[model samples]
Target: MSASSPTVPETDPVASGRPFGAVDVTWLALLGLTLLTWIVGDDAALGLGRSALLLMGLATLKAVLIAAVFMELARRGRMLLLGLGAYLVVLWLVLWLILARG
Candidate 1:
């Protein structure tokens, strides 16, 4: 017997007017955020303490996005994603406090 080919839906976003899907959008966002972080790190004159905190905050955001989107944890493992996101936020806060105190 001949195998039937899988049919593509006519309403698919790629097939329609939209070029980017959720993953593509997420990737672009990550790229932009990375560029912003690089710029902030290179030219942020907000003092060492503030700069460190800002960089850490940006890093935490990137980490959460990567884990949620690229890792597919957001869809498949809500609890795990939440836990990781919470942990990242807490770590960022704790580090910022420590750096600020010093």
Candidate 2:
């Protein structure tokens, strides 16, 4: 409470040195997903084309979860979310096109 110390609003947890709850959960989830992915890879989940598709789907889901929760994109403006969605859609379409050609 000294005059020399800058005062911050009590509502801002970041300013108070408290960790973000969501960040911890997101990190744990990411670690679990990474382990799952490794297990899937060892089991030859990427061997067949269909299995590859499933693996890709799982990876995309993990990416989305990490982006939304860890990156705090969900709380961002609608425009940012929309852009992310569009990028994902485009990536999906490109992958589908490439797979379909083979």
Candidate 3:
């Protein structure tokens, strides 16, 4: 590569001139939420069913966050977001049906 070519450095964002992006903030928030969810979901006082539901809800939230931020669904056209939402709804319905049977 030529010296003049733009090089993507592996430095931290704080060191780089670029400001922190929304995706970075969303990722960090998701990480914290994941940790908190695990702690709360694992608490013995909540009981198995409630804990499982809480974990499941957290998982769903994480999935949505990843889709919106990392996948750039938030900036994408409404139709694309709608399609993704529909797909997720279908997946959730199928998963619910399967889990309900057990």
Candidate 4:
């Protein structure tokens, strides 16, 4: 209540109407994906081609999640996000082609 100290607004997370934001959700999703990736790695029944493809797909999903949430691309970089989406599509296509040919 000092005259020199300004009182801040009540804008804490809960007061803001959303306790868990996008970042929290994204983090949980990433953790789940990591666990799934480990499980896929440890499984011995899947052939190399299937395993590699699954791993690659999981990696790409993680990459997109990180970029959109951690990098704040979803808020300020629409063009960059689009470009990244395109690049990932192309990358996946090439990987699939290579894996299929082998």
Candidate 5:
């Protein structure tokens, strides 16, 4: 009610309705990733190191999907977006180093 404070409209784009198909697709992708992780469990075909790498990569991909679509973090916040990018890079690098070591 303060004159100085800015008020956001109820029709903000973020709050607007989204096409239902997009949500369906995101849900399917999440389910597929879950099945993939389960399928990769205790498999010797790729060996231990490579399997670990593959699993970690899938995990990162899943995280990105959830963050971007489910959490809707992709809509705004530049610094937060940059943080997600940095997180993915640092995560892979750490995994790569560990693989190299062991």
Candidate 6:
């Protein structure tokens, strides 16, 4: 997820020398990702397991965007990183338990 996310600037755009459109592009990307997740999750042909995996991936992507851009954690401490890692782990565990059938 972080692989696709843009690194947020540590300082204001004026100081960082980035254009104002960067924020707008991030906002649009978040919205588009959310919509895509919703659409893919609702596709019956994807079946349960595939839909779950795809949705989980999308959710992680959205989370990354929120943390890195909206929350400004690109250059922050490690707590946020730990929190996100824990969140994905828990999410995968729950999905495994629910999707795995003996």
Supply the global lDDT for candidate 3: 0.72
In model 5, where is the ten-residue run with the lowest total lDDT? Answer: 6-15
lDDT of 4 by residue, 7-34 (tens): 5335434456767777898999999999
Candidate 5 residues lying further than 4 Å off, grouped into runs, are 1-21
Task: Give the range of the ten consecutive residues with the poorest summed lDDT in model 1.
Answer: 5-14
Q: Candidate 3: worst 10 consecutive residues by lDDT?
A: 6-15
Best by TM-score: 1
Task: Report every candidate's CA lDDT.
Answer: 0.85, 0.68, 0.72, 0.81, 0.73, 0.74
Worst 10 residues of 2 by lDDT: 45-54
Better by TM-score, candidate 6 or 5: 5
Query: Cα deviation in Å at residue 62, candidate 6?
Result: 0.2
Q: Candidate 3 at residue 31, lDDT?
A: 92
The residue ranges of model 3 lying beyond 4 angstroms of the native Cα positions read 1-18, 89-102
Better of 2 and 5 by lDDT: 5
Report the number of clashing residue pairs per model: 0, 0, 0, 0, 0, 0
List the candidate 4 regions with Cα displacement exceeding 4 Å. Answer: 1-19, 100-102
Error of 6 at 98 (Å): 2.2
Alpha-carbon shift of residue 17 in model 4 (angstroms): 7.5
Give the candidate number with the greatest lDDT. 1
- What is the C-alpha lDDT profile of model 5 across 1-102, one tens digit per residue? 689864553444445655454457888998999899888966768776777787888888888777776766765455676689679867976886688567
The candidates, ranked best first by TM-score, are 1, 4, 5, 6, 3, 2
Greater lDDT among 1 and 4 belongs to 1
Regions of model 1 farther than 4 Å from truth: 1-19
Error of 3 at 39 (Å): 0.5
